[model samples]
Target: MKQYTIGKKAAVIVLHQLCMILMVTGVFATGYAFRHDAHENIDIYTLISLAGLVGSFVSLAYMANVAGRKSEDDYTIYYLPIDKVYSDVMLVIFTLLMVFMGKVISGVKNQHFDYASLIMTAGTFTFLFDMAFIILYQSIVRKIKGNILCTHSLMYKGYELLKRVIEKKDIHTQKTKEIMRIQEALEAISEGALDTTLNVNEFHGQQKKVAEAVNHIRQGLMSSVNESLKNEKLKADLITNVSHDIKTPLTSIVNYVDLLKRENLENENAKYYIHVLEEKSQRLKQLTEDLVETSKITSGNVKLNMQKLDLVELLYQTGGEFNERFESRNLTIVTKIPSEQIFIYADGRQLYRSIENLYTNAAKYALENTRVYVELEKADTKAVFTIKNVSKNELDIVSNGNVDLTERFVRGERSRTTEGSGLGLSIAKNLTHLMGGKFEIKVDGDLFIATITYNII
Candidate 1:
């Protein structure tokens, strides 16, 4: 079963219950003072103080409950009239009953029913005020069904203010700037906004401004993402056209070279030249295929057939495939596998390619004879796959310093000098995302680590 910590929520609930009691007591005191004669010197102001204290406490409870509800419940359910409001209404009724009793007591004490009508009126007024708020909230959103949800929904008023700025704007220019500012403020607030308290008027004003700013920023980001997608399509098309043009002639050239060798051009000098040409041609073909596949992945045209697979087995198979390649560079693959089958959901082929890229990348750029460490583990309901390799040079890509360090083809300053198309990590990153996981690369000194995590439970 899903569960939530009852620490703060339980506290608020207790506070709310206490406030309800105080509110009822305050109502009775106020009514008693109203029914009393002016000459009695009954010190009616004392009742007023109790009422003030009760109202203040209740208001705090309401605010805290609202904040708690918003955190745990869906925004759409926030406007729903829940049991908490009904419970509050019930308390108001109890307050009215107590006030009526207080009136009778005061009347008996003062030996007069002269202020009876006034006491009843005061009781009626307090009851109506509490009931009206309870009824009015029902006309909006419903909150989630749980103690936690009820508490957070109390902040719906603040959320609604922000929602308005985003949806009900007229002038795009003013609205856009406001939305941007709101987003900035929200970012700051998320960083520490709740800790800093402010009055309703000041807080709501700031909230509206932040909401407007956020709306503008959201629209702008969406537009930018669309443009980036279009540009990627264009890049893919260019690569496609270029590949066709280059491969057609190369295919014929290779066929003609074979024919030449068949015609006794296999002499020492002729064979040496032919071998060089064949190697260069094969290298170009391999590079072209990599470019095409990488482009397809980037343009979001490739689909992966995913399934549940054993993580340790997959890693072992991938390492074996690259063993011959890495052996030439004196690179070693050191793996630390637990004696248990770690299962994960992913496309086996894509996962293989991703890991292969990491190993090959290490072989190409890592220091000779260095071991590339591969480890698998299950922690916190996630399957973690980590690959660590040596870095020969400093990485030089600056993607606005996002710090996740997995933004596509970013290589170390030293690795950039090696022969690579720089699309290996980018493809791996996208593949991880498609597989419902995260891919992250971190650089520490001479070591570069690629980590992938997927939820297994």
Candidate 2:
């Protein structure tokens, strides 16, 4: 079916009205001719009238069947023979036919001035009204909302406005729907949707191009993420292997160094060298073990054993081990813990380690003769342990400065004069979180603070 433009429809309306008028004139003229003589020979006027009747019927059928109806390319089951646009046109045509029929009947029966003239006059007025009605119908089509096929199919009144506009699809319409589908897929992917695939087969031209591009990007992203994860796993495995390899040989060296110390050899320099060697080897072993443990905590490889314990007692116990070292650094430990026991549910080993890290960190770099404040108290539903001290080195603390320190190998001391592998805080923080505790650290100039909060039992 050809597409109907406004100009084409207007042409159709004009032709239909002219056909109707001619048909009515012919009908009246033929009726009068036959009425005058029943057996008159066939004349040119009668032949001309017959042709007009045939042409009128053909014109009526053409417009009634095809005009304003959708050209559906897909299979559909339409229960109604006539669609909305044609139905209204048929109603108007029927009403006009009845009006013309009545007037023609009157003119035929009346002994009026000229019957042919009266019939033509009746048709002239009818065709005028017919043309006006068709124009009004075209005006109606202009007011339908965007996307008529989706909205106007409820068998309601005034749906004729969208009757001619509705179609299964056109080239532009198919392209629009495909473009929308592509956009929907893009949104889903951006929000981390993984399972759904776009229907590239349904699209054409640029829509298909867009869908394929998105699919390719998604594949690339998944590949990149997987590759990154694989590389991280290999790095973690390498750290574990290196730690184990160094520890095995280091254990023998430490044992031999201690054995040599037990010998009563009067060689002072050899004994001192053995002591230094033992100390340096032990430090190296501790650093390697810390690296491996940090990896395990981060990767969730360590199993936890949760139990109820007094948080205040645990803090005092951790502080005790670091007391001699704290005094050596000229730092005094000050406790502000509640006298009442505050119990919490946590993995004892990991919790103790987290606390030890904070105390050791303070003791190692706290300003000499300054107090390292260790405070434990109840805040809402949590038992909070806070450690604050004045840092020895000139510190540059900004927003996120202390938070970033929890990353492995990030240390406050640039040259690492103090004995630490920099994995202490990272392991402590990760293990704290794994055991359902919150660890936070803050640094303001020389003041360094670490707070660990656990849910009270």
Candidate 3:
């Protein structure tokens, strides 16, 4: 389809040009024949020849106009037409007429007949030739306009490649303004001074002025965005640090308050209230700290500092920390960790916190008299840590895993009724991620399991 359109446009342009050239030559030939009067009884042939030339030139003008339209529509600019039938016909007709006009003109000039009629005929033919050339010129001008429009379209579509070119123009404009301003300032300073001698005061004033002018526009845009994130991150880190730091003292205070209330120094129910206050206070402090830490990890402020450590040793130590709570509720703590160490690179302290949170969650929410299983194993390049305990019932929906648990004041449906900060797993998740590990939860039947894994770096 493209080839055909191209060929057609080329044919029109070539034939038009050829017809124009022939028409011009025929005009000259007709003038010469009319002058010489070479043929007798040539008036009819001369008139026909003149008409044929006029016709061919008119066709040429029409064809050129079509070529301009096609070029405007981007039909073709590279192909040439092959047909020369119209051009050949015009050439033959004009050649014969030129011969007849020459004979007639020569005869009239040599006194075979009066030249008045030939003169009038020549005037008419000249007028037709001028009209044809005018139309041909208009067509060329239209084609030029078409070419320019097409070139503009091509440049507009190539925006990406020429993007820098436009930007440079804008940059140049800005620079020109700056240069003008500087030049004005310099002129003012020079005018104020009588001599070319440099003055320290003026020099300092100019330097300060330039500095003030060239200051960053509202600081670096990228830096401003980065700082906002850092500020948010700093606030979160502060909350976590403050919460965790205060928890130990707050827990001790709660314990002491309960001890005082239980000694019967006041109303009997006072002891119960003190216990409740202690429980609630401890939960709040722990939760605040956990949420802060969670924010820090999620916001990408925390970095992993993994070190090779024994999985078996870590799990055992973490489980032992929850021994008192388990014993108090007649719950059994089961271990599936091998005696041999499973070494993996992870932040030991953070990993410890993760384990402790898992165990604490189990002890707080697991069914009474049920066994809690803790397992640690090395699989490929990762160390998998699993803590599972029997739940009271199947939860309607699984927990939103670590994210919701980490949110400030958020709690699980069934476990909100129990004693908890609701930030344990959230903290655990943060710690796991900090150690370059992943944390996840799964529930099967009546068992709720929290798992964390670290790559064996």
Candidate 4:
């Protein structure tokens, strides 16, 4: 099959159709000669040739099928291994039937099933059977390499699925039954399933080890998760206390800066120092507040007051509030909101923050003098709030792909002068999840799109 080029594959198909024509004509000619009783010294060469011709047709059909069933130019992509095997088996059966028919026709044309006809039938079956095995073996062997490479074998596939559930931090939902079952098993173990032991009866030998390892890994993962969660709580407590601790002294500095500004200082440089000190102190204060807020939001410290709210009205309000900021950058807000008021179940305050972060993010980073698009779309049960804009800085795919972007302090740029603590998107993402919504971020060329999808009420 590999020897056959694209043109050859097509040519083989055409040749198979020609063989069918010859087989039909041979059957009719043999029939006509038998009726006239002019079959004396009958030549059986044509009958044998027709058998070989049908065999060739079957072979060509099998080759054409294996190559063209997938994306035409590629051999690596196969739909199903079992289906291919079944087809090969069927082709062999059909070729054998054709050869048997030729033998039967010869026996009938010549008087009785004599020694020659018997020899011909046995010879045809023996030769064709060997050919059948070779063809079937080749078809199955080709699939073995690809299937093994993808870890699709029973044991390998199960092992790989378990490894993923154990190693990956965020457990994603899967749609496949086998993987999904394994995922659920991991969850059961993580959630303190006392029977972490896999049934040794169900799996044998090394496969049993894989199941045991999955259970072992799950136990270890649960322990790690519990410890990390404790540490996280302690860290959140520390951040909250530290922020409060610094706030008291930071408040004193602000007061002193304010007092110094009111006093008549003879030195202009001294007054200038006070102004700079005030700005730095204020920025630190803002950073502390953002940190404490993000920690609370992410760690489930913040209580969500979920309620039904008009999404359209919220968008309008958020847009209107940022009108001045957008105007400062000479950026226009292009809205594609639905005409009617669309309501959804969510924490109004949190949803406002999420929408505000997206809008403000676009307004700040969007190319100056360009338009920022805010569209509200609903399909089936989900409602989408999408905002797209051209970034002011170069949007690197490597950075975007590697970084979660929703993780705390994971900024796109290394520079601190970008006017954000980089907690904006993180906060928005967490808040959305807290309110039972999905958030997605995509970067293409200079365009940045952030979409938040939630169940429509």
- Top-TM-score candidate index: 4
Q: Tell me the tens digit of each residue's lDDT in model 3 across 1-457.
A: 2233557755654554444434544444455566677555355545655665676576555555455344444644432222112333333555666676567545544553334564455445544544444443444444354453333333444765477766555545544545455555456444642122222233344554563443332134336667887898777767767767777787788778767765765675876777787777776665665666666766776666667888788777777788999989878988888788678787777777778778877877788998988887888887888888887654434644443444444554454564566667777776776677899877665677788887765
TM-score-best of 2 and 3: 2
TM-score on alpha carbons, each prediction: 0.50, 0.55, 0.43, 0.56
lDDT of 4 by residue, 1-457 (tens): 2444557655654555445444544554555456656585236636744775776668665664554234444666443444343444445665776687668556545654444454454445445443444444444544553553234344555777788885573454332433445556778876877456565455555555666778778668778878998998888888888988998999999898999899999998998899899888888887788888987985788998989999999998999999999999999989999989888999998899898889878877889989999999988888899999998777655455666667777665444373777788888998898889999887777788999998888
- The C-alpha stretches of model 1 lying farther than 4 A from their native spots are 1-225, 254-272, 392-418
Candidate 3 regions with alpha-carbon error over 4 angstroms = 1-266, 291-305, 393-410
Question: Over all chains combined, what TM-score does candidate 2 have?
Answer: 0.55
lDDT of 2 by residue, 269-358 (tens): 988898898888888878988988977875669999999999888877888888899889888889998988999999888899888888
Better of 2 and 4 by lDDT: 2
Best by lDDT: 2
* lDDT of model number 1: 0.64
Q: In model 1, what lDDT does residue 3 have?
A: 26
lDDT, candidate 4, at 361:
83
Which residue segments of model 2 deviate by more than 4 Å?
1-214, 340-343, 396-403
Worst 10 residues of 3 by lDDT: 79-88
**Candidate 1 lDDT, 1-457, residue by residue in tens:** 2222456545554454444444554455544566654434344545555665676466554544453244544332343434455434444555776677567545544554345554454445544444443333322223333333334443655566677875665335554655455555557655744332222233345566555555565556657767987898898899877987888887887787777667776479888888777767766776677777777777777888989988888878887888887788788888887877888888998888877778777877877778878888888899888988876665553323444444544555534642665667877888788888898888776678888898874
Q: Is candidate 1 or candidate 3 better by lDDT?
A: 1
Arranged by lDDT with the best first, the candidates are: 2, 4, 1, 3
